[model samples]
Target: MFTPVRRRGTEILDDPNADAALSLRSLRDIALANRFFGGKRAVVREVATLLRRHSGGNEPVSLLDIGTGLGDIPAAAARMAGRRGLVMRTIGLERAPMLAAAAATRCTDALAADAMHLPFADRSIDIITISQVLHHFEDAEASQLLQECTRVARMGVVVGDLRRSWLAVAGLWSSSYLLGFHPVSRHDGMLSVLRGYTEPELRSLIERATGCHAGVTHRLGFRITAVWSPRYRRA
Candidate 1:
């Protein structure tokens, strides 16, 4: 067992040429973690708020979920929207073809697309979500990614990721074993905690990237979520 330092480090999943089975296994574990913990719940709550605000309309809202590995978050949001009487059309984007294929099973509208270069027009999507994916990028790329997210979203964007803390690392380590996560999952989970950002750090990064006032809130299970609506209208 290797002890991860309290610093950002690349996980094997970051590699484009990694093993497919390992990557899918890790994604499954991640989906389970988000489901049991507050990852999926946090995004669902934010989506619920937006749904309520955009209610009283027959038109279905379009939600584009970026880096939707197993499509758990968007799938959950779509299901929740149905229960709340809000019509939603959920779409998931995954850069990896295999990931996109797997996500398509969970979300019918999944596509293979890059987060940095979204295919949608400006302000085309009602809502956009990026879950547990930000920590993989450096400062500059993260900022660019946020800008892209802001560009496509007409209403708001939801970002959920791990919060950097020793407690979080230990919790992930213990829970991975308890929950029967894969070996790669365990390693990547711990590394993700180490690579995570604090609330303030995330806020600054998002604000810089999107050029909008955004607040990052720390939630249960050492997760941090930011819900930001662009203040300025798209040109």
Candidate 2:
């Protein structure tokens, strides 16, 4: 329920080593340090439930989790999809080699690749998800990535990310110290808040990029979640 801001071009922030450092930390601390994991779990669960309900029975589902830092959500999706006799074929894509290696240990398949250029063929994936990852891209790249997600996904795309607000900033700052996260985690967490897009802004970008409107909603009070499908497809 956030309004769109005036569109403006911005520089993309690159932190190639950020995910690598996080991977080196204690897994427990990494999970606790990032508040979005819990919210992302809920969102993924809800989406899985919806997909199952819509599919009318359990069927194999392929999921491409872009920017899957630690493969948590993809792993969760695999479990959820498994209940319906659905083979959860998941490919976790990460830019950092260390994170990709860590993710491979967590999930069966992991690939190191750029978000802007996914290795999958068009309409090859059932679902494409980006959790707490899109804000790392600038406006233009974010739009392009959205298009790529749509191109690669046959069913739908789900985005789970923080909603930029002063309250969010304050919460992140307090929790960073409380969780004893690494210095880079705390610093990047705060900066990510500042860089995050409101729900409307995300919707506008999706609409402009895909020439199709998208639905945006807030999740877990402070996270912005969006779901978009191709114009020919319904979600």
Candidate 3:
């Protein structure tokens, strides 16, 4: 019962061809979920700490947030780094042009490209973050994405995703309705919970992909963050 559910379909916002206005609305709901829930905190906290430890000085570090919905997570990460007197150059990458354009408002740069095949050179970026996105893929694709992250990141990678739970599912069901989330948003949000991974599942996946034993932690809002340096010995 603790394992992630095998979802048969995709989330509403996952569609690259979705309607512009509806997609934006769905993204807004997701951004709010990241805020009110533990998504944003889970990612930014781990990433900021990674930046501080890996950074050599006050020189700017680069961050590329994959599948960045509205770029709020990366923006929040940058602010967290700023508080520590560190600089992070954030880039949001979305498969959809519309999302890339929209996220550019907050991120320093936004890219519309295929995530499985990143356009960056090896270890070119200081940090890479993927929040609430890895569960959308199956085992092979998920590992491929992690491998890509390891290939591009000079310092480390932070992966924040939902921690599968019945309580979270039930809570989101009522809360989404109470907050008047759009039907698509409500449906997708609940479905996302069902697709979330347990701590073991996530840890094993990362280890299998990048050969790094990641540090996994649970967050307040039924979230889990897995952080690891790209330069690490295999478990």
Candidate 4:
């Protein structure tokens, strides 16, 4: 069972040490495997679906992906947008300089920046994505980061992450023992579940932090996702 931490009257989970746990080599390998197996692809597809529905298949979309470790999500978005002759400019942000450097080699447009204090101007980006990244922040920091995500994004924000449940925990354990995953990956996966947020909890956090009405939903079989838009029209 996962213990929840309460912050500002909301039950927030703990933070996971996934970035510290996974080595660069292992991170890269896992990213590659995820791309090959459509793990990241599914995430991008959902984002694309949201974009098409909300933007009415608009051209020339811009995206900012937060905590984009290996740039897989942005890269996939770039590819999908390219099919429509829409110029997709994606900027991936990571905290680790080494991880940012590695992603730059793969993405050529990634930046090293803090999520709590993003370097971008206000309302400059069409979409912001946080995929499997929020579990690393404490409740207060995560709330602040979500506020920043809302501040910078012009259209909306999309968050995709693991759901904290017994099934997820059991799957991680089984994968660790049977699938020959790296020790760090196994340990971190379990820790991530413990640190993950439930649907109502995340919705409450976003609404309270950003002061924006948002909708939360589930996707990809076992992941929780949310989308938030500005409360008022922005000039």
lDDT of 4 by residue, 141-229 (tens): 88999989988998878887767777777766775556566765666666666677788888887888888876787655356777877
Clashes of 4: 0
Q: After superposition, how far is residue 200 of candidate 2 from its true place, in Å?
A: 1.2
Best candidate (score: TM-score): 3
Clashes of 2: 0
Comparing 3 and 4 on lDDT, the stronger one: 3
Return the lDDT, model 3, position 36. Answer: 91
**lDDT of residue 128 for candidate 2:** 85
Q: Rank the candidates by TM-score, best first.
A: 3, 1, 2, 4
Residue 169 displacement in candidate 4 (angstroms):
1.0
The per-model lDDT (C-alpha) reads: 0.86, 0.71, 0.89, 0.71
Q: How does residue 175 of candidate 3 score in lDDT?
A: 89
Where model 3 places Cα greater than 4 Å from the true spot, the runs are 1-6
Q: How much lDDT does candidate 2 score?
A: 0.71
Could you tell me the TM-score of candidate 2?
Answer: 0.84
Cα error, residue 65 of model 1, in Å, equals 0.8
Best by lDDT: 3
Clashing pairs for model 4 are none
Q: Write the per-residue lDDT of candidate 2 for residues 1-235, one digit (tens) a residue.
A: 3433423333222544435455456333435643443655645855674475346355567888887767777887887777766777788887777768877865668988878898889988888888777887777898899989989988888887777777776887887777787776666666767777777788887788887667788766467788866745423
